[model samples]
Target chain A: MEVEGMPPARLREPAHRVSPRAVRYWTVNALLGNVLAWAVMFVIAWFLPEGRWWSTTLVWLFVVAMLANVVEVVVEPVVRYRRTRWEVRDGRVFVQTGWLSRDQRIAPLSRVQTVDTHRGAVMRLYRLANITVTTASAAGPITIPCLDTDLAEAVTAELARITGQTRGDAT
Target chain B: MLLLTPVRTLGSFAVPLVLAVLGVRRGRDEDPWWLLVVVAGAALAVVFGVVSWAVTRYRFTDEQVQLRSGVLSRRVTTAPLDRVRSVDIEAPPLHRVLGLAKVKVGTGVDATRLELDGVSAAQATDLRTYLLARSRVAGGDGEGAPAPVDAPGRGGTSYLGPAQPETELARIDWGWLRYAPFSLSSLVVVAGVFGVLAQFGDELPIDQIDVAQDAWRWVVAQALLALVGAVVLVVVVGWVVVSTVTYVLTWWNLRVVREGRGNLRITRGLLTTHSQTVERAKVRGALMGEPFLLRLVRGAELSAIATGVGTGGRTRVLPPAPRSVVVQVGHELLEEHGPLTMAMVGHGPRARRRIHVRHQWGTLLVTGALAVPTYLLQDLWVLGRLPDWGPPGLLVVLGLVNALVAESAWRNLGHGLTDRHLVVQTGTFMRTREVLERAGIIGWRIEQGFFQRRLGLADLMATTAAGSEVLTAPDIPLDLAVQLAGRATPGMLDDFLV
Candidate 1:
């Protein structure tokens, strides 16, 4: 086992990984959007539907969704920060994520065949973009969604550096 | 030249049109209930046919070929003649009867699958002959002598033209296939026939079986005898037929002319023939397809990346060749005496085997899972409340198939990465030995998912500078997968983000 700040000798860091701000951005957006959705559904039900009463259908949907939402909310405070943690080691990059189930991914910067950045309208407004580091897996490409635009650029530069030095990267 | 595109469209629509008219005729066969649907369908089909007729048209140029179609969403594709890797003119049974054939020119160009679909046999031949000459002259440097208009077969070869003949130096042994346990068609027939019987629940109607009513008591007894007889009669004869046909069609008048650079000029055919002019630099890598049945028959298909041969990541290499020829021609293609497939076996002995086993699992699992809804609904409704054994049985059979593959993967997985070449030899059938130069490799990548991470596995895929597919090394160890990916050369990973 390796200590903090000291990467394992064999492991190499990817030039960049998903940053904290990007994780926070997606989480907040999803949370706010979900909360607004439930509130709207309740308002419509309470006002309309001609004497709408609590029923099994509503109970089943709302209760299950609400329960799931609560679980997420409870877990977010403890784990949201972790979602953005990225570590660069000597020859590898490691990232740990998930609010409910912890997930960690490590990629050698040399192996990153393609480092790309994508920006959408909403992301552009917030100066945020998604960065995907692609490897030839055949299953699909690996994407790291929602990164600061500047961070994406930095990641690209760092990846290019590794690829140049190591000559690894197949798009 | 008859425009069969229009004829094919008209013929296809005519079937339903006749059906619809019969269903809707007021004076005779009119049925009130089916009238609306029949009329609507016929009308829609006619409209579609007319619209399609107006859209499709193809043009040939000295430098390229263009096929344009679609009306509202007009689509046009142009393949530079220079980019064309191989042109196969296929004449199906019906095509032979009609004196018609289709020319499929593979440019190894893009994902659109851009192809010139319909052309006359004469037209296809003329086009093929012209393209062969051009490619030959264009050769390795790509721009050489002016392409001649007419080039004839040198000797008494059939459609191979005068230029390319299956090489005499190339090796092929048809007689050795007598002992093959895995014959391609046998497996297909056995699997297909047994699967159908299994679906009907092993209860063959006496009429269907010609004579059977007892439980498999006597059946098993006969089966043992039948297995021996079938191996001798059916399997052996069937494999002989397959190898004979393959040799005749692919290697007939077979000649391999060594050209400038490492390119090989190959042309051979039986009745409906094909001619391919390939450049050494253009071939990405070689792949050997070893179907289980083919393994038994000692049959194997040698395929390679003619990167610009066809659209949508297609490789134009060979119609399945006899194991003998595969070994022989493979040597010339790889410019090495050793088996190419064995060279691809993964690092430290078991790497390729591990990768092959793990990767195949994903395909089998996904296919099995995707059929769940069918299993669920069938059991819930018509299949009775009893547990549906179809999906589970299928999974078991799939597992059995994978076991065979595992054996092959285990025995064959050995890759020798030399400075100039990446030689991969990992196949049970026909012993697919392949050799690829490292300089020819353009792109490579490594990837790991959550499940893979948990298992501490990854994949290293390498693509030649010329081909569309990246030769996959699935389930490469995490460290090595990354190392390989990191070391992939630039320009190999074009459009990675895209």
Candidate 2:
């Protein structure tokens, strides 16, 4: 949430972080949608109905949309703070995060189907990447966003090892 | 062909605009309106050319196929050959004239899409052949690549993979015929022709039959007759064109080739071409389908159940086929009742299939509940007489019909386990027959819901090792369902892996 050039101490816990790309990305959707919505409300108020109720309703909507900006700004960071936690336990990756209700997801090396690493422009600047682990349950790839380079690779190798070990038992 | 699309698109757009402009100069009354349209269209032409040049890019490789396009928001999607289920080629009549065709390569990925737009027909066939070969291959098996088939004169030899290639393998495509009355183009032509006929029919030079208050009924009947006649005429003509065109397009190129191991390649196309390949190991479950109408009329279709590899698991391989061919191919292409055959190899209890047959009652009940009301409202309420609760009377009748439907579903149900094949067939209207290979089943589980638990029943779901077809016996007797699950599983991986 801070601008460039802030002290490293200004950096809070890594858990309190959002995908800088996702933040920039979602901001576009929110900003564009708000503008489009407000513009429509404005046009409707100005041309249609032609009464005080219309004008007042337009003013109320503008106030509400303006108020929504505050919430829109704070929502992701608040979410970032509450749910973000990544820990490695016994060579397996466990991610615990959810806004309304927490969900603890564990990906053991043995069950890991494939490991995918992805990065976007914003993460490039921050020297960060996201690692995704898929499994057999038809669940989406569990993405651990903003991992250190060495850590992600280590996790990938570890997961493969675990998957191999478990597969060995079945064999 | 790569150089032709932009030229062709430009030609199509430019020709009309130029013609309109020329016409505007030559003609007097239409000048002003035509000039505006020509100017606007010319501007459109420039935009299309720029976008086409900037965005178009595609690549095909041994490992994967990639496509990238879009002007404002570009997208790049790649499908790995290792995960590919099939590569389909389509040719519209326009493609026949152009000598180019479209290919859709599917890897069970979320971003699966059409790739290699408008490759030459021969190149499209070659690409399909290569991908199908790739699907049969295990990673890094370079020895048995494409040589066996390419060396056609060496017919006595066989390709390497899993199952033996049977000389009498069956593959029948009735799609060319199915498209006759059911084609989208045919439907559109019928609608358009009917609209034209209806408009022209009213002005037909027919003598007036009557001039009275009650004559309106006769007049309405005549109009209805004309409308019906128009519809039949359109359907007949459109069916003739579509079926004939499809036959010409497909029958000549019809081919079914068996390659090394258990690979089946089916290639057919008229203008825009199509090819389908199914490897034995990848074929999890094979099922036959015929909607009620088709079943009554003796028509059929086929589908494959396979794991949506790399796709996060959300796809089914449905290659439409003829009924008789389905029965023949279902037995040949995959293990008949594979992974579930051990307990029922021959004259075995077949208890699992029988239990599955019993489970059809649930779907029967549900179908009955849904259909009863529709029939009553549409069929019984012809007279607009309201008896306090007018809709309720029909609603009651609808519920009764749904009950009848459920009864039919249960009565018509059939299942069997024979000669190591586990077969579960069920349907009220159109039937579905699933054949499984006991050894191929990867895993099995017995799931219990509160309602099922209360009813002393459970769900038995099993997966094949290849992660394709998932066969389930829902709402079967708990004891039997559990027995089948255990039987189907039976240390499944121990026998297959490592």
Mark the regions of model 2 whose C-alpha exceeds 4 Å error after superposition: A1-161, A164-171, B7-75, B109-114, B128-253, B306-323, B335-385, B389-392, B412-422, B436-447, B463-469, B492-498
Q: What does candidate 1's lDDT look like per residue over B197-281, in tens digits? A: 4565445343444354566557765875775575457544555665555545554554455543345555555565554555455
Superposed by TM-score, candidate 1 places the C-alpha of residue B58 at a distance from the truth, in angstroms, of: 4.2
TM-score of the B chain in each candidate versus the native B chain: 0.59, 0.64
lDDT, candidate 1, A1-171, per-residue tens: 122352222333333455555545665566876798689767755665453344545756776887777656555644665444554455444554455333334455555566788887666766887666654333334455666788778866876677668631232
TM-score of 2: 0.55
User: What is candidate 2's lDDT per residue for A43-130, written digit by digit as tens?
Assistant: 7656755556547767787778778775665585456444566655564555644444433344444445677877676556555677
Report how far off residue A134 is in candidate 1 (Å).
8.7
Chain A TM-score, each candidate: 0.62, 0.59
What is the Cα-based TM-score of model 1?
A: 0.59
